[model samples]
Target: MPRALVIEDDHKIAELIKIHLKDLHYEIDHTLDGLEGYEMAKKTNYCLIILDLMLPSMDGMEVCRKIRANDIASPIIMVTAKSEEIDRVLGLETGADDYIVKPFGVREFQARVKAVLRRSLGKFENQSSTNNQIIEADGLSIDLDKRSVQKEGIRIELTPKEFDLLSLLAASPGKSFNRQSLLNLVWGYDFEGYEHTVNSHINRVRAKIENDMNKPSYILTSWGYGYRFNENI
Candidate 1:
């Protein structure tokens, strides 16, 4: 059975999540402290991580950042009581795969979990289909199977999301993708107003891969449409 971790301070909430996850056939580890949860996550490979935003020892945002920094690419579902747009946006920018606000119904929470898991599965499937495929343009090289990127013979480390975004664009050079399309293709969910998520990720990708952010050669703004890879390269 796949494993799941729940890092929630509220005993009742944690138990509720645990019960539902058990029903879903996931072997579960429950922790109320963020530091301990982080340690557990580092040691164990979990299929899903449900983390509360406000945690003792470490907040969820910090935990998410640290996990991504360490290259732990497990899908994470952030649980927050705050409903503000900034909080949700920050959570996503921090590397969370999804977030669910408190006071959410069980159905909504379950749907989010299913959606994240489905997306993870879809990533694996897509990778298999493109196995051994490599796209080269200018100095940039993307190995789809290895999920690695290189520029001018030097390795460039990218977050999982960053790699996905870059690979998607590179796979179809000159094909413009609107923010909504990118969001649906990359995030696996339609987050209506979270289009800024796409912008922030694009900026980060450019910062890493482009020689000049001011005049990027790889990814170009489509002018009133969205963004696309430079076919000229």
Candidate 2:
């Protein structure tokens, strides 16, 4: 069973999540304080973390930053009452894999959790495989086995999700994948309704791969259709 750590101060919300996750056969551990949550995350090998932005001892953003700084790569899903776009972006920038606002449906919440866990486990499997997958396009080279990307002979540091997004687009250059499609492909089948996650990750990827994110060359937008990779580049 996959282990999950939930850092939520709300008793009702935390209990709801624990019950649902237990139904899905996940080993659940939870805390009502951010500091304790962060400590537990560092000491354990959890498959995923459900973290709330508001906490008694420490804020979730600080916990997230500390976890990333410590090289903890487990997937983190931020649960926040704050629905502001900037708040969501900040969570992602702080190394959160995904985020969901409050007043969310239970089904959607469960789906997001499953999706994150699946993606995390899938990455582990991919890393174990001996796949000769080095995608080169427009002065960018991505090595799947090594899990690294180089642009114009210079290595770029990318988050795990950023790397996945780039690889998906690079693998099918010129193919436009809608936000939902990309989410399902890169995130997992269980991911639902948060297309913004795709948009944010794409922007981050472009920042690393393109000289200017505003005028991206490798990953082009298909307007209403979605986003496509520049195969000719």
Candidate 3:
């Protein structure tokens, strides 16, 4: 059973989330204020965190920044009423693993939580494995243990999801994986109907690794098929 922390100010919303998470066999701890929530998060060990952007005593962004600054790598999913693109981008930039808008369906929220947890666990397992440490294709290098990628001897920064998606494709160069397959492999079993997630991350990865994202060289699209890494470079 995975442990989770819910930092939400709304009692009703928190209770609803707790009910859903309980059904999923997760142990949950919650706080109503941002300051208390941040303290609880730091003091306890949790597999994931469901945080709200608007909170009393402190702001969600401040808590997120503090958590990242403290080097807490536990996956965090922001739950916010604010649906503005800028707010979403800022949440991601602050090291949030994912975000959910208010009035979200219970099913979708549960799925997102499971997906984030699965990705986090997959990374942990990959890091612990010693057999498949690093993979190189052409000038691109993927360090599974370090969770880093490099091209032409220069480090390329990638979000966690971006790294996982790219690493999966690079590991099996030339093997095409459709949107749903990629979502299942990278986002986990619980992910559903969020293929756009894969598309956006792919674009970001290409922008970093390829000379031109518009004309990607290493990661190639298979038209109506899907995406595959070019093994021959």
Candidate 4:
């Protein structure tokens, strides 16, 4: 069974998440205090972390920053009651692999967790078998073997999901992929309305690898179709 960490302060919410996660066959550890949760997370190798935005001892953002700073590569799903789009985007930009709003149904919650884990598992299985081919376009370089990306000789730090999205698109240059296809291929989720997640990741990736966000050199919008890599690059 894969280990999971749930850092939620609300007993009711935490218990609800615990029950569903247990049903999924995960061995979970829970904590009400953010600082305590961080300590527990550091002590264990967890496959996934369900983190709440509000907690005692430390806030969710700080916990996320600390965990990433510690180099823990576990996927994080940030739960928040704030429904603002900015809040959700901030969580994603904060190194979290996914996010869920409070008041979500058990099915949606479980599905999100499963999707994240499935994506991680696929990446792990492909780490060795992924043809060790290097992709170079303009000033950008992607080392599939090292799972590293660089632009203009400077290494760029990308979240695992961002890198996966970039690799998938780059692997098939000039192929226009709709958001649903990208989500299914990169996130292991086929749900509707989450296409914006792909858009956000694409924008972020372009920001990192492209010199001008307004006029991207590599990633190009397919207009009616979705997105595709610049074939001319």
Best-fitting candidate, measured by lDDT? 1
In model 2, the worst 10-residue window by lDDT is 121-130
Better of 1 and 4 by lDDT: 1
> Lowest summed lDDT over 10 consecutive residues: which window, candidate 3?
121-130
Model 4 clash pairs are: none
* Superposed model 4: Cα runs more than 4 Å off: 1-6, 11-48, 54-74, 79-95, 99-118, 121-132
lDDT of each: 0.85, 0.80, 0.79, 0.81
Ranking by TM-score: 1, 4, 2, 3
Per-residue CA lDDT of candidate 1, range 69-125, in tens? 676778899988765668788888778888888877778888888888766544534
Q: What C-alpha lDDT, on a 0 to 100 scale, does residue 214 get in candidate 2? A: 78
Full candidate order by lDDT, most accurate first: 1, 4, 2, 3
Q: Estimate each model's TM-score.
A: 0.78, 0.63, 0.60, 0.65
Those runs of model 2 whose alpha carbons end farther than 4 Å from true positions after fitting are: 82-84, 121-159, 169-233
Clashes of each: 0, 0, 0, 0
Better of 1 and 2 by TM-score: 1
In terms of lDDT, which candidate is stronger, 1 or 2?
Answer: 1
Better of 1 and 3 by TM-score: 1
lDDT of 4: 0.81
By how many angstroms RMSD does model 3 differ from the true structure? 6.6
**Against the correct fold, how does model 2 do in TM-score?**
0.63
RMSD of each: 3.5, 5.6, 6.6, 5.1
Clashes in candidate 3: how many? 0
Q: Tens-digit lDDT track for model 3 on 169-217?
A: 8777889999888867665553465566577667767877898877788
- Tell me the tens digit of each residue's lDDT in model 2 across 135-220: 78878898876778898899886666777787777777888889888877776544555677688778767776888877888999
